[model samples]
Each structure stands twice: as C-alpha cells, then as structure tokens.
Target: MNVGIVAAGPVHDIPDLKKVNHIDYWIGVDEGANVLYESGIQADLLTGDFDSIEPNRLESIKQNTKAINQFSSIKDETDLELAFLEAIKLKPTTVYIYGATGGRLDHAWVNVQLLTMFAEKHLDAWMVNSQNEMTVKYPGKYELNKDLSYPYISFLPLSEVVNGLTLQGFRYTLEDQDINQGSSLTISNEWSEKKGTYFFNSGILLVIKSRD
Candidate 1:
C-alpha cells in the first residue's frame, strides 16, 4: 500500500492535497488530523497527544477519524514519529510526508532523519514541501528523468564520506570520486539528457530535487 501523511506545519507550505495521485492510506499527526478534515480528506489513522489541538477540535477529530492513537505530551518520540511507527507497521511500499517542513528547523531536521530511517528499512520514503522533494539513498545506481518542475538536483553525503561516486547525463560528471561531509561539491546539478544515472559504492546520499 502507498500511504500519505500530513503533519501540523503550515498548510500553505504544501501543494493541493486533494489532487494527489492515488493514496491507499492517510495519516494525520495531531493538528494534522484537523487539517485533513478542513481539506475534506479522510484519514485512516490519526495519531499524537492532541495537546496542541483545541479540546473541541480534538473531540471533533476523534469523532470522525476511523482510528486514533493518543500519546502523552511528554513522550519519548515526537508526534510525527509516532504516526510513522503506525504507518511502518502497515508495511507500505511508499510513504509521502507533507507539512513536515518549512516550520521549526529542528522538526524539519528530525523529519529528514525519518526519511533516512525509512530508507534504511529499504522502503521508499519522501518528504515534499512547497519548494523541494527530499529522500535518502543507500549505495546503488538509480535512473532519473528530467523534470522541469524541479530542475536542480543536489546530493549530500549523510555519512562522513561517500565512495566511488559516478554520474552520467548531468551538467557535472564524476567518476570513482569520494565526497566527505561539509562539501558543496555536488550541489545544483542539471540533467543533460532525458534521463540520467547515478551510483555510489558506499555511504548514504541525501538526494534533493528542488526549484526556485
């Protein structure tokens, strides 16, 4: 199953939720459940402490949602992570997270870590916001198509170093190169053909596809 999750960040930071491609399941984290209701989208699971939500609004959400998992406000995990645990339990092939960025820097950073967590599980996970789409990849070759929507691609090593990096069909090319942390060496690359290929021998890569 493919799952879509909406969090409690600024709704304005995301695209139209109604127009998304087929989503098999929907998850709302705390105020995100209310956001889904406001957008007239149904949620399969609603999770969080409900501390940030108004009492009446929380009641309304509890009434309409099919399932709910409320946690203590001072739990070990964040609301978003709790929601992710349930989503992962369902074993979705892919999970698309929205409203998880463009707010608190710390929260956004945690969400990126969540992306990496899913990637390490060998599941397809992506974070989408107004300006960018982000994901983490373990060492492997990937084929990508040119998209005018997100014309720029950047790769940042999540680990200390990435080894034997190679790229084809891009404005910049690399072969058997190693990139360490704190390097802007792979930022803002453009596709040179209809499709391009990328591969690496070791370490995790954070692939960001973005546009102005």
Candidate 2:
C-alpha cells in the first residue's frame, strides 16, 4: 500500500491533491481534513484532537470520513505521530507526507524527526512541500536522477558523526570525509555533471533537494 498523510500546516504550500494519482489511502490530521475536503479529496481516515477545527467542520468530517481516531488534547503524541503509526500499521510501500513544513519551527523540527523514525523502521518516506523534498538515509550509496529539476542538494548528518562521506558529480566533492553533526561542511552543493551520487559508511543523514 502507498499512503499519504496530510497535516494541518499551510495548505497552499502543499502540492495539488489532484496530482496524486496512486495514493492507496489518505489520512487527515486535525484541520487537515478541511484542506482535503476543499481540494475535493476524500480521506480514508482522520486523526486528531479537533482543536484546530470548528465544531461544525469536525462534525462534517466525522460524517465524511470512514474512520475517525479522536484523541484528547493532552495526549502524549502529536497528531502527526498518531497518523504515522496508523500508516505504518498498514505496511505501506511508501508514505508521502504533505503540509508538514512551513509552519512553527518546533513542529517542523518534530516532523523532521518523524522522518528519522520511519527510516529507522526501514520504510520509504518523504516530507514534501511546494519547493523542497526531504528524507533521511542510512549510510549507503544513493543515486539521484539528473532530470529531477532540484537545483540545490544538501546532506546533513543526523548523528554525532558520519564517516566515509563521498560525493561525485557535485561542485564540491568530498572523498572519504568525516562530517560531524552540527557542522556546516555539507551544505548547498550543486550537481556539476549529469548525475549526482553520494555515499557514506556510517551514521544517518538527512538529504534535502530543493527547486527554489
């Protein structure tokens, strides 16, 4: 299964819901349901405390969705977490998350951490917005297509250290370089050739590719 989760962030920054053609399931987090409804997309499940949505809207959502998992406002996990757990339970081949960025810094950071959690489970996931796509990767070789149109590429170490970092077809190549977390060594590298490749031997890294 391939699932898509919509969070209650900036709806305008999200890609057009109509463009997503192969979503097996749709999940709405809180007021995100309203965004989906406005975009003429139906949700398979809805999860959140309904704090951000008006009572009438929430009632309409409850009537429209197949399943609703309402939680207390003082729950332990965030709405995104709850939606992620449900998506994982479905064992999806890929989980595409929208409306996860361009909001509060704390929420954005937490959403990034959620990507790490999916990576730890050996799942393919991405936090995608209008301008950028973000994902975490374990130490390994990664090949990126040249025609993707993302102008800038960045690799950020998620652990204290990422060892044996190497890059090919990039403006700034690093061969067997060790990058420490919080270091600005791996930032804003563009492809110098047709294809770009990155490899690492240890630690997790967050790869971000952006168009603008």
- Runs with alpha carbons beyond 4 Å of true place in candidate 1: none
Clashes of each: 0, 0
| TM-score of each predicted structure versus truth | 0.94, 0.91
Full-model lDDT for every candidate: 0.88, 0.88
lDDT of 1 by residue, 87-187 (tens): 88889988999899987899988888877778777778888888998889998898788889999999899889999999898899889899998899999
Q: Model 2 — TM-score against the truth?
A: 0.91
Q: Superposing all C-alpha atoms, what RMSD in Å does each candidate have to the true structure?
A: 1.4, 1.8
Model 2 segments more than 4 A misplaced: 192-195
lDDT of 2: 0.88
Please provide the root mean square deviation of candidate 2 (C-alpha atoms, Å): 1.8
